[model samples]
Target: MKNGEYFISKDKALLQTETIHQFLSRSYWANRRTLAQVQASIENSICYGVYHGTRQIGFARIITDWATMYYLCDVFIDEEYRGQGIGRRLVDLIVQSEELDGLTGVLGTKDAHGLYESFGFVRDPDRFMKRRPTNPWA
Candidate 1:
């Protein structure tokens, strides 16, 4: 998807691991994540990257079986590029994409609930639960 000079792509080869690591490493949820861990995660998930020319500026990933449900996570837009609708467009493409059609979606966010809510996500505290791993990196 193209928006003016910025475009979004699922081309994993175009993903800049270092740039992604830089963004994720500073993000509240993934601050403790290592570069190697980020790389492995990217390799396993469907990754969406936003770019201007060749410089990557945003990213989001979905863990899905492409059958039943999908978990959207690690979403971010470069601090310099936040108000540009890049994050929304990136997510719009993901949720509206044929790959995730008709499947249940889930995500966790301490903030940005409003953003996701616009895309049809609602608070489901009663049914939602989490169990952190004993090994922090596991």
Candidate 2:
């Protein structure tokens, strides 16, 4: 989906590990995340990469069963690319994607509440649930 000079695509091949690793490693939520871990995460999820010409500018991913629910995470835009609506566009595509349209979506963010809220995400803390497996690092 082309919006202005940036385009969003659910192409895992379009993702650059260095970019994802760099941002995630420093991100408040995923600090010190490794490149290999990021690669595996991308490989297993429905990923969208936002690009400018040949360079990637942002990314979002959905971990879903393609049925009743989805968890959105690792969403970010490059520092130089912030303040633009690119991040919103990425979220829009994810929330409105055909496969996820009828499913419940959940996400955790210390900030950026306003961004998600605009897309119909409500902060119902009682609904959040998580359980870490022994091999979660894998």
Candidate 3:
């Protein structure tokens, strides 16, 4: 989808792996992820990349069953490109995509709740649960 000078696409082939690794490595959620891990994750998930002409400026991924549920993760817009509604459009496409519509969507965020909430995400602390990896570096 095109938005002004930016566009979003689900073509994994269009993703710039090095650029994505760079962005994710510094992210609060994926800070510990290695380049290989990021690559593996992208290969396994339905991926999206936001681009300006040719350079990728944003990314997101959805781990889903295509029928029941999907976990949205690794969502980010370049620090230089934020505040431009690029992230919003990237997510809007994912949530409303035919593959994800009608399925339960969940995400984890220490901040930026407002962003997701605007798209119908509600905090469910009581129902949410997680099991941390035993190896911190794993």
Candidate 4:
């Protein structure tokens, strides 16, 4: 729970939809991602929020079956909070969580390879492929 000046909580109430919408809409990997899509994702996934007391500073989600595999996604820290080790601490807590035990984990990041690598992630260039929705809004 407590990691230095930050802490991780699994409270969905801590999520600010407007703030998440604004950040993801501008992110290269998920540009223009609609609020409905974001809401749907949050509703379905296991969400973790990083907080400094009552302030939500970061978030991450895992889409998983809990018995086999999990895909970590939407991991982000507020731009103002990046320099601290909060991001790393957040990820470490997730990876070590009992809920995800014994599952193969995967994540996609255009960058941040170094950060993820520290947590036992590696390139699987030949093992992964993706297909985007033909009509994201549809």
Candidate 5:
């Protein structure tokens, strides 16, 4: 534990794919990520984990160029760990990091828009976009 109550750390190298897979499986939008995909994502992006006595209770990832743009993805908190400000702390650590300082952080959420809003995220009507991928296995 980092501060005697919450375990916070930014060590993707130590993340187990199985743990991440289980977390994403419970996520509302990302229940289909496979172990291989999760492993690749963890290896390629910056990831953070919140632990409760060695069990990962929350997770979040950011895909960024470290210069101009960032997309926050796959944020989830174990149902047992919700309502304790862990999610806020996770977001805070990411947004306040030097790696994301000058970039525009973006994320799409079906729920919890209010949480992101409290962290300065806003809906940009002009930034309309579309998804091009037709199949995940393609």
Candidate 6:
């Protein structure tokens, strides 16, 4: 695989597991995720990975009802691979995907707001709410 080339976006269960592991190892929000746990999560997600000759350099996942709302999550691009438009292309592919076509796409990011904004994602203060467990270990 080269830039702008991907093997396929479907049948991604196994590939998703690997992609998550690669990301969580580097991502602050998910650095504690174990391979077994990540594998289980991958089995239940609609995931996409961008590859460069068999190495996954970017990844994202969407959890959705497939009818109305889609939460895009875990987007990442390897540091060495940034500025190549891979992240933008990944978002484009997801937004344009027939599987997600008429649903609302949502995501939360501490950074990269500009990138998502370029794709028509806006901060809708009235539509967002969140809760975090007081004791996540429980």
Off by over 4 Å in 3: none
Candidates 1 and 2, the one with greater TM-score: 1
Model 5 segments beyond 4 Å from truth? none
Weakest ten-residue segment in model 2 by summed lDDT: 129-138
Candidate 1 regions off by >4 Å? none
TM-score of each predicted structure versus truth: 0.95, 0.91, 0.96, 0.93, 0.91, 0.85
The whole-model lDDT of each prediction reads 0.92, 0.88, 0.92, 0.88, 0.83, 0.78
**Rank order by lDDT, top first?**
3, 1, 2, 4, 5, 6
**Candidate 5 lDDT over residue span 1-138, tens digit each:** 275677778887556668879878777776777788888888888888888877887788889887789999988878887998888888988888887898999999888889999999998868859685679754
Q: How many backbone clashes does candidate 4 have?
A: 0
Residues 1-138, candidate 3, lDDT per residue (tens digit)? 888888999889999999999998898888898889999999999999999999999999999987899999999999999898889988889888988879999999998899999999999999988997899685
Select the stronger candidate by TM-score from 4 and 5.
4
- Higher-TM-score candidate of 2 and 3: 3
Residue-wise C-alpha lDDT for candidate 6, range 59-100, written one tens digit per residue: 788899988999998888888889978888889888888989
Encode model 4's per-residue lDDT on 22-133: one tens digit a residue. Answer: 7788788777688999999999999998877777878898999878999999888989999898899889999999889899999999989999999999999998889988
Predicted candidate 1 versus true structure: per-residue lDDT over 1-138, tens digit per residue: 889999999999999999999888788889888899999999999999999999999999999987899999999888889887888888899989998999999999988999999999999999988887788775
Worst 10 residues of 4 by lDDT: 17-26
TM-score of 2: 0.91
For candidate 4, the TM-score is: 0.93
* Winner on lDDT (4 vs 6): 4
lDDT score for candidate 2 against the true structure:
0.88
Least accurate 10 contiguous residues by lDDT in model 6:
1-10
Candidate 4 wrongly placed segments (more than 4 Å): none
lDDT of candidate 2 over 10-110, digit per residue (tens): 87888888988898988997775678888989989989998999888898888998878999999999989999889988898888888898899999999
Worst 10 residues of 1 by lDDT: 129-138
Sorted by TM-score (best first), the order is 3, 1, 4, 2, 5, 6
What would you estimate as the lDDT of candidate 5? Answer: 0.83
